[model samples]
Target: MKPGTFLKSTALLDGTFFERSVIFIVEYNDKGAMGFVINNPFPRKLNELEEFKHIIPFPLYLGGPVDQEHLYFVHRRPDLIEGGTPVDAGILLGGDFKAAVKHIDEHTLTGNDIRIFIGYCGWDDGELDAEIAEGSWEVLEGGMLL
Candidate 1:
């Protein structure tokens, strides 16, 4: 992986999207990319929302164009769940869904501690690199380098 790649649990660089939008990448590989929009803050609250009601109070995100209904999250606190992989300093990605639900049920996790997102942005293999080469995307260090 490259530096400033956002890794797993790191927040998307600021000013990269709508105001205050923060994204967390969940899966990144040759197949494509996937993550959640953590900071978008839709008009609805968790209790008032359906679909992900099982994870009440967990903030929702605008992941991207891929699977808008799919759910994903990123957390820095690994002790709260199992199966998470370390992405970078102070960040952890991926985890057991049941563990996460238990944490939510027990009130051990909150929106600030973890972010939930629907949908995701993606690029087929070599597509991202091509975008960079074509100047459609810019690579920068430390935060959203548009």
Candidate 2:
């Protein structure tokens, strides 16, 4: 629906990889909906990557079935990470990457305050509504599970 809302896969997704997945919505509007799987962690840590091999270890998650070539992130430490768009009362979507890494290196930002993803989930205009109508997902809010 809107940012800060979470979409949880229902039994309808039992036969797919999205079964039991929980997605954190970062952007949503008439254009479409976009979010990242809060669960579904990847096998490798962020530092294992070639470009960030020197940074401190951070868990990487499989956001969704969309474009996985690029990396994305969400965080809560706006005071430490600037330029991010607020998703909820305490959450934010995207911001200064260099500053984030620098803070992580400086021990100011920990994994608890951030989540990295290889890709992101997306839905075209009205596509998500169709899925919801089909009972593929259950909406959750304020950190509560459905």
Candidate 3:
């Protein structure tokens, strides 16, 4: 398993949720799969946006074709949070609108250290495994999922 890689759900096909979308899998296992969309970008910057201006400063990415109005984020700073699980050795993913705003207001966090996204990519049980066996997905190992 690589640190950053695109993992598409085999169960997601021809739906309003995930059509022709590529998701960067942040976590995966028997429990489930979690990821963010890489190709879709939200045209608004958080700092200038009315609702998120006080919360985040980063430009949001369209995490997936589903729920295009929700907010999600991935963070890498573990020192700020006590006992946060690492996505890798040094990377972590966690954020809420309130927490993000508080961190930003206090100048404790920066957009460079995190990424915001709208919606998310998900997979049900045994769905991704089938795709892996069918060779429809390619896994990569590196710093980021790009």
Candidate 4:
């Protein structure tokens, strides 16, 4: 698997953290692998959080089972958001948060342009490969996935 690849959890992971989850890979290499669960939406919005209460209310998603206190984001607006690392094609991971907030408040950035997440999923070394080989996930390819 590579960056921008989507991994759909199989029935093998039923009743687990990855049950029926769809993950968007942001980094994949010899060192490790990391991704966000694109299909799981968190019930709370940004405005409900103490730190982000000043920011506009925006939908938040449950990225995975790690780093729940921090925020992560994926966007297609590198031109508008700036400093984003490309996952593939036009998709980007992280960027200038100040600029993102500015654009967001100014109505330049919308939900269609970015997806914010709390936490992320990660696998060390060959852990992901082993899981895939065991049929825990089905890799989906082709086209840009937001």
Q: lDDT of each model, Cα atoms only?
A: 0.56, 0.86, 0.65, 0.89
Ordering by TM-score: 4, 2, 3, 1
Candidate 2 per-residue lDDT, tens place, 10-129, comes to 999998978999988888899999989888989999889898899888788999889999888898899988899988868888899889988887788887888888989999989988
Each candidate's clash count: 3, 0, 0, 0
* RMSD after CA superposition, every candidate: 5.7, 2.1, 4.1, 1.2
Name the top lDDT candidate: 4
Name the regions of candidate 1 deviating beyond 4 angstroms: 1-4, 7-27, 37-39, 51-56, 144-146
For model 4, the run of ten residues with the poorest summed lDDT: 137-146
Compose the digit string of candidate 4's lDDT tens values, residues 1-146: 78999999999999999999999999999999999998888999977888668878888899999999899999999888879998987899999987887887678999889999999999999999999999999988774556
Ranking by lDDT: 4, 2, 3, 1
Compose the digit string of candidate 1's lDDT tens values, residues 14-86. Answer: 3544234444444567876544544455555555566447655654556665776666666767887777776
| TM-score computed on alpha carbons, candidate 3 | 0.69
Error of 3 at 20 (Å): 7.9
lDDT of 3 by residue, 84-115 (tens): 44566456666455666577667787766667
Between candidates 2 and 4, which one is better according to TM-score? Answer: 4
Better of 1 and 4 by lDDT: 4
Model 2, position 104, has a per-residue lDDT of: 80
Candidate 2 regions exceeding 4 Å error are 144-146
